[model samples]
Target: MKQGFRLIALLAAIALVAAACGDDTSDTTTAPSNTSTTADAGGTTTTTEEMMTGPTFDIGVTEEPCEGGSPDRGCILLGSVTDQTGTFAAASPGLLAGHELFWARVNASGGIGGLFDVDILDSAIVDNGFDNATHVEAYQGIRDDVLALAESLGTTQSLAALPDYIDDNMVAAPATWWSGWNYPESDAGLILEAGASYCVEAMNAVDFAVSNFPTGAATVGIVHFPGDFGEDYLAGVKLAAAANNLDVVYEQVTLPIALDPSQQGAIDAVLENYADVTFLVMGPNETATIVGTVAATWNASGTDPRPFIGAGPTWNSALLASPAGAAFEGGIYFNSAPWGPWATDTPGHAALRASAEAGGAPASNFVSAGWVEQYPLKATLEAAVAAGDITRAGVVAAANSLGEVDYEGMVETVADYSGNSIITSSVVSAVDAAAPDGLTLLAGPFTGPTAAAHDYTGPCTG
Candidate 1:
């Protein structure tokens, strides 16, 4: 079964590359020029237009030495610490499934440089999430053994241990970014945001709301929990609203990690002063409670129609299914990743389904992000191994070198990794439960000129 799946993955990747190559049908690989040519005998002509060549991969085969003592049977150890219990547990299992699929295929096809073995350590940081100390301990536990770290989800915990991580020379494939993704130029080696910062997601969601939501007073209210994730997003919504000329009204901060604040009066206060657009920048459980509270109150009054808007984290499939889900009838959100089920035709999706089915994961849209993220993570590490150097520096360099990457055609735009901050595309989707797919895209990747392209908009500005 593993061999068959690996074969399928290779064929899929080759098919994708072939399709992309076919899209480029130009010949004259023009070289760079200095002088301009004359168009009308005496008139000055524009400089010759040069065709841009895409990135080149090491297509040929190469071999490298294995790092560990485990019977040199062609393998390299890549470290991993997943949040399999806490807030991120929702996507943790699926992400692991993706890793399994990627490496399974890679090893089956003769491994990286004819060697393959991914050593993963279950970083037992679950529900409430891991602290900085825990993150450092986990890394220290296996620092001397692995070639590179694949995926570590906690931004706060990881950022806390960033200093040691850099000193140890570990190249992390992808890290979940909070508002503070923009570190100084010196820390560039340690930062590789897989998706857009949560702030970007907030800004995009606000932008979508302004253009599409039912027009009214234009006042906006943002409710958030008092954590890095919540605070950062709340700040982002305000910034986006200010730039877009939208009003900013009531804002609240609840306790840490509590789904809903114990104080009912506080919750009612925010609900009472609602605006045309309300941004719930809280975690999953709290988001559900807030929505449920509002819905129950409004339903009791028998009247009052207001649109609630939330960032991606708050828009969980389970939460939306709750009674509070009904309150968000006109709610909308901005997401950094593609809508999973909606993208059934994408290569990423095909690969994800194959892996999930094989691994016994529930085939749900929510699991697709972890599913797709794992593929690129795997491919990035494989490329690093192929480079013949498994040191921390090698891993980081390999990650940065991944140019214009498209995940099996799953992601809409190619990932851009040029500056200190990694920038990728963002998708705008509306929270419409009535639709066949539940959520729908409003405007899209908006990969236009004027949008922040590879530009690092620094930390929280509130």
Candidate 2:
């Protein structure tokens, strides 16, 4: 009986080795010719693309069976549910490349702990198109195939898929910072954000703005979307504003995340209030549009300059190349939850940039975002494997067990996921002509009293 079992295991190992070794090793992806712009983000409100029934995009992974006791024999299949097309298509260059290099390194290292390779199955990289229905559908179709989702990009989309994740006995690495995701009671060990939730980022940013106000007390305005991503920021802004005695001059959630051709109403509101500072929480595309539009309005109005601040996911370094670059080049700043830009001197971030550039990917923040997702997964998976419970449920427990992930200095503060709550902080950076991605570091490892006050112990109804 023992000999029979050994024979079966050996054959399985051979098949695994063949599967692991059968693919071309080019790490670079041919970046799509076009990148996303402000128009694309604004157009999301008015997009005409019919939701495709099936996303055929895949990473095209092939593996070879391995010998008994070899590292390749243990397969840890991780999935990615991200925007490959639709509204956020332009941002995918860095997003996809980051995940690719993370796994590439894992494979090259003879798999994690020299016993298992994290397999990002090609067919499983489905494009969510930034749509809730599509995100859920893509996840449903692939739920049976992967042990867990390594990355699920979009706040509402990821939240929509939460029930499925729980029912399917898995968890995911969400590319968002909704406060609810930070709560143990709400997340139930499913959602894991890359940095401080919007609530924390807003509080810290607001505090910074208030501290730097040169004259009379500052007045603030917030132009945001309506979803948790947006509401989360509103909550934080309000918290900080109240705490610091700043006047909430104007605040509105008038912009639709979908194709809204113009946010003139929102822009006009900020200008009308003449708020000294304005906080934003929109995708990179819309962020650029709003920032440019408002700057133009302020510039044309001949009013005092109103500096703009944004949440991490709300803006990307990609916008500096757009006409909006002029606005950012001005006196504008943004808070990023993750570490420094690709060219940052930090060992983890710089190394990721080198790998991404070598793989033919753009040296941008999106690529680093991908690396951040893998950081916790790597930590959790390594712990799980060591604990001898590497199945779907095991991964979830292991993920929960993940106490801290440094991302090789990608983040100023070590991320803590064990409590199922956000660590509540961020680093600030600014747009500059000389920085790697038109951005220069400011300050970070920011913490706020308001952020600490609201840990989001329940599901975020917003």
Candidate 3:
């Protein structure tokens, strides 16, 4: 029996290795092109057209202060706001570490355009518990000074302050888990950068479970944290499941961050009522707790195959701290960014590990996001500045002008606005638990359709 089990394990490992090494194919996409034309005619004899490019300027990033460094040349800022004090604080340091490493690399390369420093601005406020008003204030504090907003961990805060930032022509690269912000692509041109939207992430999870579990995952269950973010995901799951003909036997919504007794009970009620493959959309800790409790209960009762599978923020390193985390063995999930301890091969991943070692900070999934986003931001800003415009209009114009800026050997795909640049979807790295850590690249980032205008494109409908 033991020998057979060992053989099974070895085969699984081989399959995982093959999956990871199988494909590094790029998703080919084209962004809409932006062109500015100047025309002149003399005596109706000859006509000539000229393209006037914008001014070149600095791109700011989160930075560390150094004495005796050149002043004007290295003073550019790389702004950051994270939930270091909030429920998601566990992942904040990793995000910051990745940002810092990317910043260091850029600065070592003589800074952007040889004039700007990636100045690091941190709004490490806790927001007194995800209050919307506090988010507005946090954003206000950093909005004016930074060249561009790099990574925001708080979704509520990002949504609240986004309008004002856009009004001021500030560009934002957010970790928004909601997909509703996208679609009809012309909307919210300020949201130049985004992690994989929840819609895609949820579907990735769905696809993984169905493919891997097969006969085991005939029915589905959903347990989501309550909020615009969770709700958006719920909708996506339904859409994807229905389209795929997957049956959903259970669905329940819980609180945004906490899983107190009552909240846990609410979750338990759903799991009890609808038994099947479960989808979790809560944080790491909560997911760990629920998985341990629910799995033990079912395992003890001899529920036969047990809950098939699911995905959520619950799969990060933080969850591994839980003894019950082992319960997630063989579980599947979807990841937007490609930087994690499981993945040390990518440039961004290596940079993150180096940063973590240098700073003595623990790396998490969020950190990988920070690393990848820097590449996009750096590439976009470089192209924008090179196009000659540093003003908001110029930056937007340059973004629109880009065909596809390649970064770290990958093309950063984005939506081509008339003058506004937006990133569409990209393939996400699919993750599972095993040797080499199961960070597999999945489908992506195909350039979806763009909207006529951005502001009127989101849930608020402008």
Candidate 4:
């Protein structure tokens, strides 16, 4: 795999060529202007500097790479609360392993500027069990001990602990992709969100499907679970459909996440309606079942296949390696994540693989995400230490002041932490047997029909 910056966004970079003029107006080569013209809603075009940096796949490590363990520092504690026994338990091991290995690299480099070390084994890792009460209890038990949270998984559980984090002026790397973080009104800037939100992913999915469809306007079916995560996707699909003039032929909201016997009926309803595209928003387990059901039941004696679009949470390596992948091989699509798959050959992916292998951790895409999760935490905390202030509020200021964090070249788009600090770009990936984790990216680093276009003034209507 080629390792370098590959800009896919429509930045319109203007490279000026100086054909050595013999008359010699000036011997020095004139630098080309780096501005591009993008039209505003007013129908007038104006030049604007790129708000974000181009993509890269080579960000190797935190600023400091701790080799054979750093100097004798006191201790700098950063913690993460992940699900170990609940609905998302299947994803917890790999996710937590990523975070653990990230700090392991950091601690080896000399522990947060060589002043303090991160303790992932002791009080650093907590199990939320995907339960809100457990999340609250875990945070309450350890909030005062750690510097800031490295990760807090789950939408509902993170939402449950928001008040406490905000009240304490604490910062955390939220594991959820809820678009509410993009709201200008909400001061949850403390929660640094990595990757694109569900809203933008939905928009990108619709855009991809519409761009590739053969002839007439397409009809989209939206089957989502009842929560902010699913509703964020539902809201985006509705927005994209309305904007692109696509039909919401079958929209079934309030679907519980259980592998309920009623799921087959919902599958039947969408298929019966002849939706050109189906968008599913749920966890990996439910996704495996739904996708499997559609692939199996879509044919009786003959074969009729349609496009299946799924959100990021619906992806897992286990499912891809299971019977589910065999059933839904050709016609399934998943949106691109913040980071690439395990098979990606970038420096970051290589390090993660080596760490997982040495540590005997379950390697998956979530582990890559767990590694990406440390980007902002390291950036903001390092800035705080540099300023000689390690207080809770100091870390908040440092985090808020950050405008961008390196994704180690694994991510195509650099995360801009400015303003709302939401990374609003995603690629549409197809399921590929040859691809790592069974994902082959198609289109995007695309951003439109984003949260910027939606109404995030209030809570997501689940």
- Reference-based TM-score of each model: 0.71, 0.80, 0.71, 0.77
Q: How would you encode candidate 2's per-residue C-alpha lDDT over 1-462 as one tens digit per residue?
A: 000000011111111122255675653332222222223432332222221111111111112332222433445677788887765676666777788798777667776555566767778889898889999999887887776777888888887888888887677888777777766667677776666667777888887777764643478898887788888888888888888888988887765435676777777787688787888877777788788887777689785676778777666766778888888888654645545655566878767867877787766677778877777778776776666456667667777777766667665445456864455666677777676666667776657566667646653345
Task: Show the colliding residue pairs in model 1.
Answer: 74-116, 75-116, 85-127, 86-126, 86-127, 169-392, 259-286
lDDT tens digits by residue: candidate 1, 139-179: 67766655556566666666666787678766554435475
Q: Give the CA lDDT, 0 to 100, for residue 217 in model 3.
A: 56
Which pairs clash in model 4?
56-409, 57-409, 58-409, 59-408, 65-109, 66-108, 66-109
TM-score of structure candidate 4 = 0.77
Q: What is every candidate's alpha-carbon RMSD to the true fold?
A: 15.0, 16.2, 18.2, 17.4
**Over the stretch 1-462, how does candidate 4's per-residue lDDT look in tens digits?**
111111223344333333465675532222133555555556545443432321111111221222334434444566788887776777777777788888887776766655556655356578898888899888887776666888889887888888888887768887887777655345367777777777777877787778775633378888887778778888888888888898998877534444374477667766688688888887777777777877777665365667677787778867866667776565554544554567665677787778778877765677777887777788887776665456677677777777667766665434456554556567677777766566766765566554347554553543
Candidate 4 has its poorest 10 consecutive residues by lDDT at 54-63
lDDT of 3 at 24: 38
> Poorest 10 consecutive residues of model 1 by lDDT?
1-10
Candidate 2 global CA lDDT score: 0.68
Error of 1 at 306 (Å): 2.0
Q: Model 1 residue 230 lDDT?
A: 73
Clashes of 4: 7
Model 3 lDDT, full chain set: 0.53
Go through the candidates in order and give each one's C-alpha lDDT. 0.55, 0.68, 0.53, 0.68
Q: Candidate 2, TM-score vs. the true structure?
A: 0.80
